[model samples]
Target: MAKDDMDKQPDSVSSVLKVFGILQALGEEREHGITELSQRVMMSKSTVYRFLQTMKSLGYVSQEGESEKYALTMKLFELGAKALQNVDLIRSADIQMRELSRQTRETIHLGALEEDSIVYIHKIDSLYNLRMYSRIGRRNPLYSTAIGKVLLAWRDRHEAEEILSHVVFTPSTARTLTSKEALLSALDKVHSQGFGEDNEEQEEGLRCIAVPVFDRFGVVIAGLSLSFPTIRFSEEGKSGYVKMLHEAARRISEQMGYHSYPF
Candidate 1:
């Protein structure tokens, strides 16, 4: 009834504890039978069977047939694999991002395409106090960010179009691309030039340049970018920033097992 009363309920707490116990027992080995699981978790056969059925229906546990033993599905492994990849990616990009920061004294970001949005997975802050303020897990729109554009540009045309189909063309600034056709045209340019640029598109007075980071399969997996303020940006230095970003991204991509860095 009350919050404190709810916390005093032993049944509710025990159910959760029991579920984790069953999962741990299953994790200790391959397949497990209901009776063996019940004994391992110190639960009744009926309770273990019920939890197994529930987990099975949710795709966490699998059984070959009505009489077969249950085993864990690959969903958990897939999630773990994705997390490991991000860890490896961040570790590999750290050195290069620091180098880029030292060379330009601007914010450096490493972002990956996540279902129509770009997520910052790693970053190096600018030396100046007046730099762009951002965090590692911030998500930015794909239509207005240099990292977003570069991540999308290397994709197959049909796939890229499909991905953009769900993206809302919201303008953040006067320079933002507010139409699918306009973004597509810009993407074509990014694909050809091997980089992407944000000229105060996502935010006023901020400029960013990004290059793609490839994976072992030669696929564009991430984008490495440099962020600068308009007051500090110069046309002559743009090429140098692009060159530095490409070199850092190239080394990171190579470490990721992509030897043929296209850009």
Candidate 2:
């Protein structure tokens, strides 16, 4: 934007824009002195130095000792790596979720652990009008959902416990596991069985089945799940749905570069 327009923005907004400008300029070179950076971002030397100081303090930029030059840090690259991972995962999961939708005529979801909850990143709606209500970006409790169980099931016991230590186990339904001890037991069962079951724990009359999708390092990065209503769920048919979800998750894990799918 023009300098005049930028000047009219809220001070907080303008400061953020200036910070990004400085960071972008620094990214184009290994290092930059204040004079060069200010010239590149069309800001004054004092403004550039002030932002650089803040960034440096935050570990996003580094200053050469005894020099007036600043450089980008590895911290930004680490943040980008996390975002790029999710992008690649979704790109690879789209076709697989679609194929599962075509065969099962049920809702399919791709979810990943964010903090202590599972967030849906991608979804394919069921072909039937009676399907469950859900959307991408929805957050579901780890103690009550199939995708959530699959996400925590593959983690180390101590790590999983640590992650859940701060969570409030609010029950979503009468069947929901409302305590850490109970949820941890369910996670153990999920780990042993190679899949997870919601069984109306998340929502009354709705059931879900899930399997893990791994990354190149065999880390369980996401969960692939199929949601159904209790009316359509059966002990016999549950096996078939689990089989399909496992196959789909295995292929998705392969697409993410992990070859040895455990299940």
Candidate 3:
């Protein structure tokens, strides 16, 4: 009986995968007719139409007028925005992030761990011409950059090792750490100091300081980072900037009702 059940599981999983593939194909193209979606997903027209009907019933996909084409509905964004708003940490930290940018006169970013990468949720641009180029929807590797390091430092050693198992460490610049051992050592320093530094690791001529932001439950929910040009901060100046960054992160965490962890 157990063997029979296990055999049926693969078929069920394959059906789910096919449905998701059809949805993804529709999302990539602005609007896809039945023929186009069937070709893109390598499924028959009948199968594609059935999947589209189901998705439309769920409000995940919609049909265009008289064209027999399907497009994604706005329901996905409504769901995503609701989830973002429900995160107490993000809601509480917005004002503090603005203040951090005002005080440091540098670009400030708020990022959260998404799967194996960090996704930027908010950004405050620097007043100067030279600044980090990151948009709100950008995702970067978790093994590089200050924000990534700070978030990784908060995880347990076992969890960190697991997360790093599949990370590609291609060197972005001469200063980028390409070895797992070197990254683990940096994580150790970030854990001890309660902050992380990126000395032109992601891009040449740019430096960033980052600290972890925790929620009321004491779990690291996101990272707050201040980025600027390397020419503006000497080694001594970098230390001062690290202090300011740590302080700003602490204040944001406090506003989020996180009082258990001391930085």
- The candidate maximizing lDDT is 2
Candidate 3 structure quality by residue, lDDT tens digits, 44-121: 899889989998999999999999989999998887864764366666767777887777788988888877889998
Best-to-worst order by TM-score is: 2, 1, 3
For model 2, the stretches where C-alpha displacement exceeds 4 angstroms are 33-50, 53-58, 65-69
Q: Tell me model 3's lDDT, rounded to 2 decimals.
A: 0.82
For 1-263, candidate 2 gives per-residue lDDT tens digits of: 66678889999999988888888888888999999997898889989888888999999999898887899999999989989999999999999999999999999999999999999999999998897888889898998999989999999999999989999999888998989999898888999999998989989999999999999999999999999888888899988898898899999999999999988
On TM-score, the leading prediction is 2
The per-model lDDT (C-alpha) reads: 0.89, 0.92, 0.82
**lDDT-sorted candidate list, best first:** 2, 1, 3
TM-score for each candidate, following the candidate numbering: 0.82, 0.88, 0.68
**Candidate 1 at 189: error in angstroms?**
1.4
Off by over 4 Å in 1: 1-22, 33-60
Clashing residue pairs in candidate 3, if any?
none
Q: What is the lDDT of residue 69 in candidate 3?
A: 88
How well does model 1 score by local distance difference test?
A: 0.89
